[model samples]
Target: MALLWSRISSILPPNEEQFPLQFSDKVESSVVEMLKRSRRQLYCDTTSTSRMLNAQIVVDISWERLNTGTWRDVDKEWRRVYAYGCLFKVAALCRENPSEDEVLQAVRTCDMGLLMGAAIMDNILQVLVRILQSELRKTAKDEDESEHVEIKRAKIVSPHVPSIKEDLAIPRMKCPSLESFNTNHLIPLKPVILEGIVDHWPALNKHPWSIDYLRSVAGCRTVPVEVGSRYTDVDWSQTLLTVNQFIDRYILNKDQTSQDGGKPLGYLAQHQLFDQVPELKEDIRIPDYCCLCEGDEDDITVNAWFGPAGTVSPLHQDPQQNFLAQVVGSKYIRLYSPEDTDKLYPHQSQLLHNTSQVEVENPDVERFPEFAKAPYLECVLQPGDVLFIPVKHWHYVRSLEVSFSVSFWWS
Candidate 1:
């Protein structure tokens, strides 16, 4: 207990004033009290069981309030309460024999706090999460080496090829210069497939984004996943799951069937995952082409798209320029110009106005007669390829196999 206390103390601020500027005086005082109570319990010669039980009771009340209120309406102070509750839980567990699951719970709790809580408080929780992750990694590595065990790798699925006309294909360029790209594509609002630009990324060569490697690095981290078929479907919904659980049920399970004997697709789409697990961020680099935009580098938004072969992103348009980089497997994509907006039937509702009501693969020619005459371009994106999509260009994407892609969006 003393050793654990020493390690945690080193990470904590020396005084309340050193806490994040966003923290109120009341929250600071509450944190100081909790830390004092924990320190006494760890250092005293005799254990005070009643003090620990009282702390648990306080945490329970906070948890109930947090679960009851509407998420956006809930007071921010409740996040602080829940975050400290998790810290106290970790302190209690460390006082006795603790299992690996107990430690993982601590890491997950901190991650949740960061996800839902105020970003200003991230400095404290992010460091705590790193410490817990390091301990888990070290323990797992030691156990593996001691047993001399070998982990079996999963087989890669083959990509599905689609037939298309060569005349309507998107033009391809091999690492065009910044000036040339601006003159040919950016100014004209054209789409093009770029090669040789992302071949040097570590995710492509040095530390290839294989299934096993992703599982090893981020299996335990919690992430939100989209469930059901495509987002346009009536049954579509979202749920949270650990990275390992998602891989096991969605990626590894060949049948891709749900427990209720129905087929449901799971997609980890449009998530800023690099912010959650910084280690994975080191494997990829931002393209220098983003400099053309008039903003700081931090203004760019990066998102990860990972799922099985049949996953589909319905035909929709984005307001910003996009560079979709494929790190593994392949995808078949189709694009329509914004000028043909009336040709494709876009939904009337504000929520889905950007998404077309017509399903490109199985369109109703009678209901949407103009759609048949809409001119478009198509391409099959391969690994290490980056496709530049102009702003407001209606694009549709379908993964050809078990795939992972990262997208960069900027003005």
Candidate 2:
């Protein structure tokens, strides 16, 4: 317990500057006082639980206020509240004789703070969480290697799907030179699949992204997952689940129905999972092609797409160029030129203006007559393939099997 406390305390910012500089002194002082009060309560034998619940009430009020504001307009005080709550949970767990469940609860608290709080004040929480993650991983590894028990993995049966025709396939290149790629694809704003480029990525070789490996590293971390067949569905919603829970429920037991007795699909789509789990991020590298963009290299956005077979990303056009790298499994992708946007029938609402209402695989020809006339290039992206999608190119993606893909978006 003393060693753990020392490690956690080593990561904390100076007492004089605990919060971000943008926050008012009032906010900093208030949060500091709250932490001091919580620490005192935690050390007290009679009032620890009651005081912790009261502190939680205060944090909940700030959380509700945080949700009421727009994304860019969120109040900074709410971040302080979340950070304080995480610190309180850490203090509670550092107390003598904490249970495994209590340690996990502390980890979850820190994760939630990272998910919702400002990054500027998250150093302490991040370090604390990583230390706990290492401990959890070691425990899991020990359990797996224990001689008293046997560990077995369930047999995975992949569903069969028809092969796509290659007559109108996207052009494929094998590690073309920068000048060649720029002249042939970038300048012409054409899509192409580049091979031999990502072949050396650790994700494809040294640190292959196998199910068991992913579970061992990130199984305990919580992540946001989309629940439904597709985002365009009326029933679509998002929920947070631990990586292991998601794997067990969605990847391993795809045939099982949801708790509500309905077959609900789970897709971990368009998430900055790398930011949450740095170990997974180390498996892949940003392609050199991204340097051709006009914006600063740091402006590039990386997103992860992982889900079971049959997951779909409805036809949509992004505002920036994208390099969709296939690390595991395969996907059937279709791309339409921006000139055919009207034929794709983008949704009228501003919220969905970038998304086409028409389903690429099963379109209603009568209602969307122009879609049938829309000429598009298609391809089957195999493992280690990097597909370059030009800006504003309408694209649709469907996983052919359980898959994990990384996309880098840059101007």
Candidate 3:
């Protein structure tokens, strides 16, 4: 069996000596084993035996041979290669449970970005999906006992009227600390980003059968491009996961808790959710694949992920630092300096200090009149862009399209 380098040759640059895969960089043990074998047994010569399926084709891809130092640039080149070979399109790939040959296949196809990000995506997806399945099973049994119980629907918080910015004053305080935000341990504020962050697990790449399974089984669909035209100019629907599947499969289960049925926010840095997911754990794996790396990760209750068309998180400050990353789509964010919290609105009720929940699109000037004077710091984060939101900085997040993201907060 000889190497099937012809098909992938176009994708690999001629210089392959600069980017040898490091053990830490490799996604799976099997792929690494095969690559190691190729060099030792056949002088890095790939063969048909290396092919995982009836596709007895192999190719030598020496990442080391490439002269480029910047992977970002290298990725741009590889993207063109995939496009030329008709292997280009946006699709999900799992990083865990990949077969030996399948792992090899990914090594053949993936460049730096996909290879790295896919691993994280695969692990997160398994946990999230598994949790959803568990929730569904619990709900199904609950339905059997009482067939007429209403299945709670996720709240559509941004459909009718645009929330108005409230007239709450930003507290005039020091640069900032948790003390300013939390009073008697009652969290005054929490930050959340609604974005789909999928990891590239081995199962997704090796098992060619997973595409339809993930798309259909998960009831995944391309997100809507427009909700009501309150977002960016790009088509964002294609990036979001079909969350309805999680509802049908997991929220309906009998073993699930009622609280679990509601919208979930943030990531859990645990792998007890799935046997396979645990095998693929990596260092610094963010729960939801989007953990806020700032200090004090635990004890911060980030309870919501709002992603409706025309949905806008009102200008408010949070107690903890925030890390917001866009996985599937994009979002437009605006922030005000802490000193100017007065220009934005601080809650008189204190219940709404951080999250005004006030309709920004439509405001009752008499009740929340101070909102009109706040200055805003705005930026839009495209896929993979991360925005760090400091505490007490009044900010608003709006979807430019059918957007998705994961946000983390720390006190």
Candidates' lDDT values, in order?
Answer: 0.77, 0.78, 0.37
- Top candidate on TM-score is 2
Give residue 212's error in model 2 in angstroms. 0.6
Clashing pairs in 2: none
lDDT of 1 by residue, 1-411 (tens): 135445665776565456433345545566556645654554444453644564565466556767886887667776666666555555565445456787677677666666665443445667766777776776774334421221233344455599878988989999999999999999899999999999989899998987778877788888889986589999999888888788877876644554245678899985557888887888988998898987878989999999878888989999999999999889999999999999989999999999999989899999999998999999999998999999999999998887899999999
Candidate 2: tens digits of C-alpha lDDT, residues 292-378:
989876799999999877888999999999999998888989999999998999999999999999989899999999999999999
RMSD in order of candidates: 4.1, 3.7, 18.5
Error of 1 at 353 (Å): 0.6
List the candidate numbers ranked by TM-score, top first: 2, 1, 3
What is the overall TM-score of model 1 with all chains considered together?
0.85
Query: Candidate 1 — which pairs collide?
Result: none
Winning candidate number (lDDT): 2
Quote model 2's TM-score.
0.88
